[model samples]
Target: MAEATAHSIDQDDFTHVVKGIRYPPVVTEANLEAMLNFDIRDDDIVIAAYPKSGTNWMLEIVTKILSAGGRTDASSDDMVGKLEFQYPDEPRPHHVMLQECASPRVILTHLTPDTAPPGIAHPQNNVKVIVVMRNPKDTAVSYFHFLEKIKFQTGQKRFPSWDEFFQLFMSGKYNFGCYFDHILGWWQRRDDPHFLFLKYENMKQDLPKAVKTVAAFLQVKLDDASIETIAHACTFSSMKASLDNSRYRGRAVNARKGIVGDWKTMFTDEQSRLLDSKCKTKLEGTGLQFNFE
Candidate 1:
């Protein structure tokens, strides 16, 4: 989500999150083991999403909504792990890190429910987890550009072409396994009081309404004026023009074309058809749908 995306591309050359774990879960076995053992806190807010699904954007929006005066910097102070590689010599265990975060911490992760840290996934943890998703077509396009950028940086081999990558994506053989599985795992938890699901396309189309919805979920009260400020701050144009966009020279910077239906330009006729067929079959009976248009 808001974690380092390119680093994985370089480390395994796009085969895995670390050495052993594959996509969907997208964490090394050691990382998963450490996460399973991590203790949960009574009050924590967790944001879960696949990479390039507007994790950073949602983080900014939720933080500002929580900020009484519409402040934007509150998220930066969130103690959730940055989702980076934990060095062997690291002094603190993963559980210790969670325990040390300031009160009411906001955590972020791309891991699906089965593999999520025990603390966040615990049945009685009482943490609020917000899951954001985008159409797979756009997610694939954004993921492609992100991998392409990372390849250049690491001098790792490119994925050959968009056509091949599409096939890989269909099979969920990419860095994260089947996109459908990632979405489905969380979709099953829709009824859980700890989970909140939102679509990126919906947020992009009606931001003020989305912000209002977020405020309610977080139990934060904000006036109409504050809502206006947050909606403006989270706009694609506003986020693209901000100085922080340039902080990373990778895909985070290319987040410029963060519009819906970007697949129109990137996917071929056959590719589009394949994705349509696969999605229909895989997502069938799940009641989960994506707005490709």
Candidate 2:
């Protein structure tokens, strides 16, 4: 089964398109339709971001907040809040399983707004969403490493080298599509009462502040001590230490170098300028800005 899954992972340039958006091969049209039509509880929380934009970190922080510092092991990777995925061995899509779980479900996805459930980002459903963003340069670098690490651990053939990977990323043909389009889709909806946009750098710089903000947004009030505890527990080092490698495939990929501007070490001058040009042009009028460092 592992070999078969690995073989499929090598299919079609390692990604499959759903409704014009690229996703991992694990996402199926049937499962995506199920997810799109899935019911969202009023109290549900959704975390949306492009791949490797500190998604796991935000999930940990929000999960801890929801539990009042208590962890929800049920919220682990196999869980359906990943919405678009349909694991190979599983009999059903993740969303079908999620349907059986109790509310207020916490969903995490790398999907852009259009492909995600309509009510997910809309205030009409009363579901609160936290949108996390990281500078695209760092996101591209991290995503490249994530794919590399997955290929190494799984013995998957046909992985791209750094140069090839960067070109794929720039072309926006990689999983989850263009970083600019994904984030900008959510950024435009930032003013809605149901949405809270966060920067990865800001969270890393002052996690306690991030924790407080998330707690408040979720209406999960926490004392100063509780907030401090959550901040400590959700730190990159702390979360990495607590990872269960057996349970989470490619788990280390989620926690790698959770720092700002690591892209500086990897991006060449030409590559850096190219990304900058893309960002500047795409984000020209939007008030949104990123701290590369």
lDDT of 1 by residue, 99-186 (tens): 6666566677777777787656554656788899999999999888777766665566644477767766776666656688888888
lDDT, candidate 2, 1-293, per-residue tens = 11222223344645667666677767777767765677888877888989889778888888788778443445444345477776667787767777787666788777777888877846465689999999999999998888877766545687777777788788776778888889999998987989999999999999999999999888877899999998999887888865545265645456777899999989999999998998899999999899998
Please identify model 1 stretches exceeding 4 Å from their true place. 1-14, 17-27, 69-73, 77-99, 123-125, 241-254
Task: For candidate 2, give the lDDT of residue 21.
Answer: 69
Q: For model 1, where is the 10-residue window of minimal lDDT?
A: 1-10
Candidate lDDT values, in order: 0.70, 0.78
lDDT of 1: 0.70
Model 1's number of clashes is 3
Worst 10 residues of 2 by lDDT: 1-10
- lDDT at 125, model 1: 52
lDDT of 2 at 255: 72
